[model samples]
Target: MSGNTGYAEIATFFRRQIADGTLAPGDSMPTQKQVRQQFGASITTVNRAFQMLKAEGLTAARVGQGTTVAERPRVAATATARLRRISRTGRAYGPKERSVDHQARLLSCADPDVAAELDIELHDEVLVRSRVYMKGNVRTIASFSFINPRGWAAVPESLSPEPLERFWQEDYKERTGRTTVKLPERRGARLAYPYELAMLKVDAPPNAAVPVLVLLNTWHDEDGPLEHWQDVFAPGLWDSDEE
Candidate 1:
């Protein structure tokens, strides 16, 4: 087979083995040299096959550990699922949201994209609250709440540690004595950036072609935008109602 076809065939061979349970999670894959010799393929071909598997979240390579089968991919809870759950429970999705176990950090907003989203100036301070939703051991969703420093300071004492969504809503009411009328959300897919990959603990290499779902939300009233939110999810973690 041609070099290109060899790489694809190599990836397919391993993918089928993984699907059939022949190559269980944590099972070590053959070394690149071994694979190249076994298939009579070039080193480039074997590396390409490994890259493909890594992008699919099926395998990982680490220093001193070699490449091994990854844990089964977990499906993330969609926004629709969370909303339905909230409708039934009359609360946030579950204890995770209500608890203080998630990660939150305050940082300077150096990224122009985030500054524009929050209607703030570059280098301004922002409060970023993050939570990773896991299905068993596999991380499914990584959520971030970006708040303008001014708005965060104005939040009431009672709602100091509340969810970002709740904080925004309450802050708006406290300031204007009126409720927010609109929360617009936009969703799209993009390759995981380095910071996101590290945050999510994804096993893919930098600039890998794995697709991550990006959900952007902005809370607004007659005055203007209240806060901006960005949620990143592993592929298949979130399914939109429209899709």
Candidate 2:
């Protein structure tokens, strides 16, 4: 076979097997060499077929484990659940209040996009707080929050060491007599960056082609934008707009 014919044939063979239960989830796939020999196909054809399987989330290849039928992808909690929990407990996720593990830092707002989002001049200093919600040792969701110092000058010089989402909410209400009414969000997906990969502490799926969910959210009140932040959810680790 030539052109895409060989690729399609090889991919269809595996797809059929998976559907027929011949290749069960968590089962190891034949090695590339074995596939090549069995299909009398080129290495390129075999690789293409494997790529298709991975893109379809039907298989995965690990560094030392070779290719295997992928296990069922984990489903994460909905954003509504997280928000309701935060509203009640002042933390993103944890059995106890104020237990979400997180970090915070002050950084110069150098990125033009961030500056634009915060309506601040380039190079202005902003406080960036990052929260990582975990189910035990397994990380569930990661959030980065950016606050414009000028708009929130009333914030105390020293912020509490705990996760700041609840604190911020309270402070904003106290100062402005307004609650955050809208969280306009944009959602997309892209391959994790180096820093994101390190922070999430997970290897990219199969061929480094699986993209994680990126959610950009801007909090607004009657006045204007209050805060702009981004949340990066690990693959299969979050669902939003759940009905």
Candidate 3:
């Protein structure tokens, strides 16, 4: 753990175990001391690695239970869960959840893919929001949401620091006198791009190029795409490629 080289060695080792089914959900992880001794990693490094896993929803530590692999959030990949969570709670991270970095903006659509998903012309102004979910020092997820002109025209509070799905709903209806509904989520995943890796601050998995778990979701109405959300989970977080 003298440098970044061995700092993540523990996480990489466990990720392989989890990915290859050598470690199943609920399987207990080695004690930090044991891992440190085994890998010759510093206690600080082990702690950071464990925290990263926990933040990624990969491992959980319970009272008297120690740390164990976490059960996959079978439904979290769906957009409905996210929408409901935001709408009901009016927030992304839990009130008790620590260390979430959030940023928002109303910017021109520069990415062609984003424009296409939002069903808007390229260079149009769109609302873009970025969030980095963090635990300790490691970033666990990088999420970006985009809303097209029609959706933004309603002046939805999509760029607010707080979750405001209700505001979006009310404003959209007040502006257009029409209600909008989110279609079933569309999911896809692939390797993280260079920018994604830089933003997420995670390493590519060993011997693999697919580093991040990507989930695509789009909200729509009678007209066209209203909002498109792209979430990229940090490396070694999501295990499946299911659609």
lDDT, model 2: 0.66
Candidate 2: tens digits of C-alpha lDDT, residues 1-243: 333448878887776565434576678999988888887888998999999988877789888889988753343334454565455444454231122556767789888988888777898888777766554456655677787774456565324446444556567678767777646568788877666766767876555765789878777667666677777777677553310
Q: Give candidate 3 misplaced runs (Cα > 4 Å).
A: 1-78, 86-91, 94-99, 135-138, 156-167, 203-210, 239-243
Model 2, 45: alpha-carbon shift in Å?
51
**Each prediction's whole-model lDDT (CA):** 0.67, 0.66, 0.67
RMSD of each: 14.5, 13.9, 13.9
In angstroms, give how far residue 84 of model 2 lies from its true place. 2.8
Worst 10 residues of 1 by lDDT: 92-101
Local accuracy of candidate 1 as per-residue lDDT tens digits, 1-243 = 334358889997777565444576788998998888778888888899999989977788877889998765453445444544454444444322223336556788888988887777898888777777665556667777776665566664322444455445565577857566435567889887777777678888656787889877766655565667777886656443311
Q: Residue 202 CA error for candidate 3 (Å)?
A: 1.6
TM-score of every model? 0.56, 0.57, 0.56
Output the lDDT of residue 100, model 1: 30
Which portions of model 1 show Cα errors greater than 4 Å?
Answer: 1-74, 78-88, 94-101, 156-168, 171-176, 236-243
